[model samples]
Target: MQVRHERPMSELSYQVSAPLKLTLEAGQIVTIKHWSLDRIDYPEAVDILPKSGLLSIPFQGVDIQFFVEFETDTQDTYLKFKNLTGRQRETLAIFYRSILSGKMVSTGDMITSLDTPVDLVPMGETDDEKASDTARASPQFLRVIWNVAFYLILSVVVFGLIGQQIWTRISQVSLMHARVVAPLVEHRNTDAAYVDEILVAIGDEVQRGQTLIRLNLPEHDAKLTDIRGRISAAETRLQALENTRQVHLNTGDPTRRVLLQAYNQTVASLNDRNFFSGRDLDDVINAWHDLRDFDDLARLAKGPFYDILRGLDVEIQAQNDALGRLKRELGNHKDAMDAVDIVATTAGTILQIDVFEDQYIARGMLAITIEENRPRMVRAWLSEEMSQTVHIGMQSRIRFSEAGQTRSVMGTISDIQASIDPDISDDFGIIVSVAFNDMNVTQTRHTFRTNAPVTLSASKDWADFGSLIGLER
Candidate 1:
C-alpha cells in the first residue's frame, strides 16, 4: 500500500500505488484511488455516478463484488459499500491485510498469487479480545427479554392503582347527596295590588333598596281621591273665609278699618320677603292693639264693629287650621300610594320572579325570591354511622357543575346539626354544612347559588389499612 499525501482516514484504508478500475451494474466505468473494507474514495463528478448499484472490481481470474452507494463530502466525492455479503467482506479484509504485511499486491492478480498467506479475521471483531469474544444472542432470546420487561412495568402500574383505591376506601368518607346553598330572601306583596311594572329579571344583581317591582293598589286609589277632594274643599273654604273677613272689616269703624289695613300691609311685606317669624308678626299686632286701645280711650267709646272684627278673626283662624290638617292628610295618602314600589331588602341576584305587569297579587302573596350575595356553602346529610367519621373544621372537597363542566372547590365542615324534624331524623340523616375556602368562594359565588347539587368527599387524617384487609378498625 502506498502512503497517501492526504489525511489518513483509517489504519485499514490504504492509498493504492496505481488507480484500480471498477465498473457499475449500470454500465458506468470508474477508477478508485483509496479503498477500505467498508468504503472507497474516488475522484468522479457526483452528477455522473449512480446513487446506488452493484460495483465489480476485476481481479486475476475472478471478479470481487460489492454493492456501492454514491455520496458527496465537503472535501471530495466517494462511494460506500452497501449490503456487503460475508464472503465479499472477508475477501476484502484478506487483500488489505496481505498488503499491510510487506507483500507485493496487484488488483489484476488473484488473492492466492501473494507469497504470504492471510488469515481472515471475522467481520466486525474489535482489537479488544474481551469485547470480541462475547457471543450475540439469537432473536428468540431478545424477544423473551423484551416481553419480561413489558410485564414487569405493567404489573407495577396495576398494583399501584389497586393500592390507591384500597387506601381511599379506608381513609375517605364520601357524601353524595349534597347541594350548594346560600342565604335566601323572599319578596312578598304587602298589599292587595296589581303589578304595574317588573323592574328586575331573574339572575339580575340588585342592591339593597333597589326597586324590584311596582304594584298599583286599587284600594289606595279611593282613599287618595277622597283626601285630595277634601284638601281642595278646605282651600276653597279658606279663600271664602278671607272674603267674608274682608267684607266684615269693611263694616267696622273707619278708624279700626284704617288700623287693620295698616297691619295687613306690614304682614304682607314680611311674608313677601320670606321673613315669617312669629316675633315680627306679634310686634305688629301688639302695636295695633295699643293704638286701638288708646284711640278707644280717647274717643271714650267701644263699638259692635270691634266685636264683629274679633269674631271674624276667630272664624278665619279656625278655617286656616282645618286647611292645614287637610293638606297633611293628602300627603299621607300620597305616601301610601308610593309604598307600592316593592324594593329589595338585601343585595343579591333575583332568583324567582312570578309576577308580571297587570297581574293581581293579594296581600302577603309570594312574588319573588332572591339569593343573597354571600359566600356559597355545600350542604349534605350524613347517616349516624357515617357521621362519626366527620367533624367540624374537617377538610373536604366539593364538586359541582358549572356551564357543563365539572369543578372542584376545597371547603371545610363549618356546621353539623342534628336533624330538627323527627320525620327527617328517622327517614334521612343528620345535617352537615360546608363552607368554601376564600379563594374558591370569590370565583364561584354566583356559579353555585342556593340549592345547586354538589358532591362532597371528606378525607380522614388516619389511614385504616386493617379495613382494606377485611379486619375491623
Candidate 2:
C-alpha cells in the first residue's frame, strides 16, 4: 500500500476542482488519498475512502473515522475508528462542514482537478497579490470556526457546573486502590487436566458445588470397562467348573463311559499283581476314580490349564476391588464443574464481565463487580498540610473520568477517616460524603466489586479544584 499524505502546513487546500474544484488557503484541510488506514487506530467498521482524482478534504476528525486506502486499488484499504473527545468534536465539525460545503479548496497529492481560477501567480508575486488571490471563503470559514469555538467553550462551562454539583455530595475519602487481577473460569476438570489452577478471580461470585475443572476421562473409562469385563469372565468360568464337578459326582460314569474301561483295567492289573494291601492300593483306586470322571479326563488332556484359569480369576477380582475404590473416591468423576452464584452481593451495575464464551479461564478469576451504591463518596488522600483546610461534613466536589457516568446519589459529608498512612504510594487517604439523592446509576457506573484503581478529586467547596489533572489518583 503506498501512503500519500498532505502535510497540515501545505499551501494546497483539500478542496477539489470541476463540480467541487477549489483552492486552499492557510489552515485549510487538504484531502489525503491512497493513504493506508490499515494501521490507523479506528473501531471495527468506519470506512472513509480517499476519493481519487478529486481535491481531498479532511471531513472527519471526531468519531475517530480513519482510512488506509491502497495505491490505485479500491479493494486494499481498511478503516479504523478514532472517536474524538468533546473538545475535538466541535473543531472537526466546523472543519468537516466547510470542506463538504465546497467552501474550501481541496489540496493533496491525488489532485484530480485544478480548475479553480489559479491566477498562476509565481512565488515572487507581491504580498498584495498573494492576499488578493486567496480562496474566496477563507474569511467566512474563519467565522464558522470561531462559532464552533464559542459553543465548545460554553459546553465546558456547563460541564464544569454539573461536575461541581455532582461532586459536592460525594465522599472525599473513598478508597481508590489498584491490584493485579486474574481471569474467570467457566469449565470443569478432567483426568488429563494435570495443571491445577490455584487462584480465583476477585469479582466472581461463586456458587456451592460448582465443578471447577475436568481431567482426561477417556483413559479412565477404558480401564473401568476392562476391569468389569475381567470380573464377569472370572465369575462365569468359576460357575462352569463347579457345575461340571457336580455332574461328575451325580453320575459315576460322568460323561466318560469310554474311559471307564481303562479304570477297570487298571484295577484288575493292581489286583492281579497284588502290588499292595487295600490301604496301600489307595493310589490305584484313585486313578480308577479319575478315569470314571470327565474332569479327570480333561485335566489329563490339559496340563495346568485349570491352574492358569484360577490365577486369572484372582487377578480379575483384584482389579474389580481397585476400580470400586477409585469410583467411590472420585465420586463418579462425571459431575465435576465450577460455577458461581452471582447473587447481588450488593446492589450496583455490573462493572465488567471478564471472560467470554468458549475462552478458557483460570479458576476463581474475577468475572464481574457490583459498584457500591451508598452515600456518594469522593475519597481522595491529601497531603498532611492540605488536610488543615479540610474538615468533616464539609461540602466537596468531585471530577470523574468522562467514562464514569454515575448519577442519582448526591448530598453531604457525614464521615471522615481520622488517620492517614504516609507509607502508601499516594502517601495519603481522605474521605468525603455526598447525599443519597441518586442511586439508580450506581448500578451503571462508579461501582466495582473487585479493586481496580480509578481517579477521584475532592474539594471542600465546588470551586476548590486541584492541580493534579491526571485521572488515576
In terms of TM-score, the best-performing candidate is: 1
Q: Give the per-residue lDDT digits (tens) of candidate 2, residues 1-473.
A: 22223443242233212111212233333433322212121212325443222223343321223221223232334222243233333433344444446464334311322222333447697889889888576587899999999999999999999997766444243334322121222332222222233233444434434322222334555765665675566566656665655554465432365556666666676654476545457656776666646665575654354445555566656656665665554444333322122233443333354544444444445544433433233333455555545666564333333356742223344555645534334455543323322433343234432223334433444344442343332
Model 1: per-residue Cα lDDT over 1-473, one tens digit each:
35433445654355443345577666777776676656677666565545666556545556666655556433455556665555566656666555556464455344443333444567864668766577676699889999999999999999999998977667778875688776678889888899998989987999999989988877687887887888788888888888988987666577665777777676666764445545556657765786678587646545666677677788889988988888888888777777767899999888799788999888898898988777778888788677677889989998878788998878999998866434224555778888888755455564775577788988786654555567786
Stretches of candidate 2 above 4 Å error? 1-320, 332-349, 357-376, 386-425, 429-473
Kindly report which residue stretches of model 1 are placed more than 4 angstroms away from their true locations once superposed: 1-166, 254-294, 297-302, 401-407, 420-428, 440-442, 445-451, 463-473
In angstroms, the error of model 1 at 468 is: 13
Q: Alpha carbon lDDT of residue 69, candidate 1? A: 58
Query: Relative to the true structure, how large is the alpha-carbon lDDT of every model?
Result: 0.72, 0.42
Q: After aligning candidate 2 to the native by TM-score, how far in Å is the CA of 409 from where it should be?
A: 7.3
